[model samples]
Target: MLLNNKEHLNVSEYVDLNLELRNLDLEEKKKLIWPVSKSVDALMNFWNSEPVRSRQGYNDKSECSQLCLGQLCPALYTIMSDGLKPHLGSTFGPIANSVWQVVEASSQQGPLTKTLNDLVQKINGEDFITEGMLKFHAFVFGLLNLRALDAWFAYLCTRESILRKHYNDSSVLTRGRPDEPRPPLPRYPLIE
Candidate 1:
């Protein structure tokens, strides 16, 4: 689990990283300069390995949180990832991507820009990066697909921590989608 602020100063690191992202506005961010689509395809491919039944929540389960965090959430994510069947993929893609976008924008819980407005000065923080992932990993990624969204929420909560740690914060949200080619919501997490 990622240590709390006690582990190190979080502000400074966030400042550095914010600079990198802020340099690029929403339109730029949408470009996917890093070629995110291919990586997304790979992740979807992995989820496609299982059948919808297997990819769906366990028959013997209740409580959305438990069902979601447990097996149900993962199942739907996988099933949705399976190539868009005309009756399935095509119908769901737009809805799914839009829902994700809403979650991405709303999850912030606040204005992130204001929070990190003076990033450079915030560098007064003193902290070191530890080796390992944060505790919210499964809860976050498993709950939502690891997209710019993953980065958005993480950045919102622990801007400094994410910047200090190595690895792409693809979890953050970005703008400019391809006509919102995601599936409808009832299929993803809300249903199961």
Candidate 2:
């Protein structure tokens, strides 16, 4: 019987499988287990084989991506908890380094400067984000959603602050600023 719509078993089946495995002797468990690299390769192959688009033009790869991400999160957490770093030659190192530059620049100007600066350092040196660095990817993925909202709020706050500054001092000159001159208003307008 199919445990889930997919060929794979669902959570309960996995639990049962785990219980069965736990009951096995050491030698039996060893025989059943595959190497970590084999598991990784299989997951990568699965991801690559998944259809990216359906006949109706809807995204089909989203489910694959979600499945991959689900596997990644726990793996990453485990890697981080174990204090292991990804191999030096992995492709993700350079990409993460480049991104760290942008994050570093943003850190200098933002509200979370200290936190961002610390994060930059964390991603530097031996802690670079590499293809094998699941924890780093997971951490960045977690941050991806908030980065947009943070940028938007920062823009609004900066605009409002500038307006207030101009309002309080008519002699205040806007230099190197992109915004067109406008009348100052309260940061939070009263609802009528």
Candidate 3:
């Protein structure tokens, strides 16, 4: 949760981090190869762990597991340390180490990121962590799988079309005449 704190990381720190990533060694980049594979394995495990059966019978797809913030923090910590940290070296060491500490604290003391007031309002505080874990799993899965990218691109295209249509309609409504025809849509290279 401390990792989520705005005060701990300023704009300059982010800029420095991005610079470090770009300057990272090729050898360090090679180290990241295994983590990418490991992430897929982790995602498969999470997918398998999801309950599939309903009261009546099995379903084609199951809803994602509940958030387990406790489990999620450690899982993310593992992903960062085992998957990303080895490749980052001294560049992201401080941030990685800080995240490790947060993982440890969250595991032992419950959700460290939530405010005291937020925790007090919960009847079963552990459930909150559970929800966080589910969201974390989904996020990680999305990152590891390019399907999310495809979905995002689809969304962008749909939004662009909607906006373009709106703009054309508005222009006609305001001018009392159809505006000059829109330019031909730009063609983008197709990904095989």
Worst 10 contiguous positions by lDDT, candidate 2: 79-88
- What TM-score does each of the candidates earn? 0.21, 0.25, 0.21
lDDT of each: 0.35, 0.40, 0.37
Highest-scoring model, lDDT: 2
Top candidate on TM-score is: 2
- How far out, in Å, is residue 1 in model 1? 48
* Residues forming the 10-long window of minimal summed lDDT in candidate 3: 168-177
Please state the error at residue 116 of candidate 2 in Å: 9.1
Off by over 4 Å in 3: 1-24, 38-135, 142-146, 149-192
- For 56-133, candidate 3 gives per-residue lDDT tens digits of 564433422322223433444343333222222345453333332322233233353243223223422446434433
Q: In model 3, what is the error at residue 13, expressed in angstroms? A: 32
Instruction: State the weakest 10-residue window (summed lDDT) of model 1.
Output: 129-138
Query: What is the Cα-based lDDT of residue 180 in candidate 1?
Result: 27
The model with the greater lDDT, 2 or 3, is 2
| Candidate that beats the other on TM-score, 2 or 3, i.e. the better one | 2
